[model samples]
Target: MKLRRRAGLFAILAAIILAIAYGFMPKPLPVETAEVKRKYMRVAIEEEGRTRIIDRFIISAPVAGFARRIELDAGDPVSKGEAITELEPLRSNVLDPRSRAEAKARVAAAEASLRAVKENVHAAKASAEFAKKELDRLRQLFKDALVAQEKLDEAETETRRTAAALRSSEFAVEVARHKKAAALTALKYSAAREPEEYAERVIIKAPVSGRVLRINHKSEGVVNRGQPLIEIGDPQALEVEADLLSADAVRISPGTPVLFERWGGDKLLKGRVRVVEPAGFTKISALGVEEQRVLVISDIVSPPGMWAELGDGYRVEASFILWENDNVLQIPASALFRYGDGWAVFVFSNERARMRKVQIGYRNGLSAQILSGLAAGDKVITHPDSSIKEGARVRLRKERTL
Candidate 1:
């Protein structure tokens, strides 16, 4: 009985030791993982932009005038030379006595002065010619001693005085003629038809064919010179103006491919970089942080059928294609981790998370190109568990939907 009792105790003790050892064994950590994928990911720089007209104009008043009539409203389509607005002159009635009588009186005064100057000029010319003939005759008689020296001197002096008087009279006539001409010009100006009388108003014509985008003058009143009247643009000539950080702008150049998304449209519009502005401006972002930004203009190359709903000034999201890869090994950017100043990925080995050192190449926001240390169909731990170590056992959970 003693021997049998000792054997039973030994078996119970062995069972207890085995149970304790099993409890202390390393447990497999549950981790979420995904198979490393290879996709054609384009490296891009994203930015905010707005649709703009390729040609835009802001019409302004060329002269100060009252807005007597407005023939078109905002959004109206206008053709070149088409009248858009009109301004009437301050005075409209030319038949009124106050205007007609004043003009007639001025005309009569100009005619009278002109007639008087003509008669005076004719008389002065005749008198000057007669004086010259008399002086010539006296000089001949004095040379032949047929006339007294004092008499000849007196004749010459009289001739000279007559010539001076004629010249003075001629000058007076010329002055009168100039005065009459001035009066006549003034009268013509007074009798001229006012702008309203001719066109009934000053017509504001469209300088170019376009759709009016905005009308700054809302009421019929005076609009000062240079004051904005309306904004016009060609809807068909649409482009995008994107604002990018200075650092990103430097990498962009003309002819680079671009992808554009409208504010609410699901379709992506393809475009090409047209211009990268050389200038930069400082702007305060929504977060109240000041940043230097540059404008990049791109031309939408996608057929209008794709972006028919887009309009000028509409907001959009643009991605500038900086680089691209095809049929290459790539993984989620989050799958990468820092391994002693180099890049590494958590890969599955023997159903456990293993830290595999890797060499990385070009990458974008969502994915990184694997230059080395990874292969297709490899399971990579995207959301690694904290309890999982390099050699620890792991249980892989299904990937969650993005």
Candidate 2:
């Protein structure tokens, strides 16, 4: 009985030691894993953009006048040469105390200027007449051999100069007369104390057959000549304007393929690079960072029927395909971690995390191209943490497919 009890106690101690050893063993780290892909890989640059008409037309006031109230609004369709608005002559100011004094002073000043110019004209005519008589006398004396040829030439030159001065003075008198007339008219209209009546209005027409995109003035008001009144454009012919970082714009060339999205459309719109503007501008980002940005114009290659909803200044997101290839090895960007000067990933092999150094090529926001040190169908830990180590035992919590 004693021998059997001793053997049972020894067995119990061995069982306890085995249980402790099992408890101390490390458990496999549960992690998310993804497979290396052998499909096509595309690296693109994406930025927010806005849609605009490829050709926009702005109509401005043809003359300085009082613009009539606009009956049309933005988005209203218009035809070429159709009258959009009318401009009437501006009304004279009401004859208030200060305004009446100013008008009277202007009239008096213009009358004085007209008198001065008329006197100058009379004096110039007198001078010209005296020069002509002197020239005739000089010519007669030269013919009688009494005056030198140089004296006769001098007299003729004086006559010609005086004639030109007379003509200039006459023109000045005409200008002064017009000024006086304008001043008198202004004073008379102000003193009439009656509301102005419009006898004629200049009609402004649309230059293009399209919808009005914007209107600078809506109500009747005095407007100057060449003041922009409305903007018109064809919404069907659309182009996208995207501002990209200066560095990225340099790599883009005309004819690059582009994909447009988030333009209130169900499907993506297609476009191609039409131009990369040569100039760059400074723009402030939301994070308060100053960046050099360039405008990249992209023509919508999609048919008009596909993006009919797009209009001028509509918001969109554009992705420029910088590089792409079919049958290239790639992996999820999350599977990568910085290892030395290159990159590394915890490749899942034989139920363990095997540290593998990788050579990376093109990388976008979501995925990266694997140039070397990895193969298709290999599993790598995604979002690996500090708990994960080289040669650590691991188990797949979930499998991610690209």
The per-model lDDT (C-alpha) reads 0.81, 0.92
What TM-score number comes out for model 1? 0.72
Q: 149-182, model 1: which lDDT tens digit per residue?
A: 8987877787787778777777877777776676
- Output the lDDT of residue 207, model 2: 88
Q: Provide the lDDT at 334 for model 2.
A: 94
In terms of lDDT, the best-performing candidate is 2
Model 2 global lDDT (CA atoms, 0 to 1): 0.92
Please provide TM-scores, in order, for all candidate models, with all chains considered together.
0.72, 0.77
After TM-score superposition, the amount by which residue 37's alpha carbon in candidate 2 deviates from its true location, in angstroms, is: 2.5
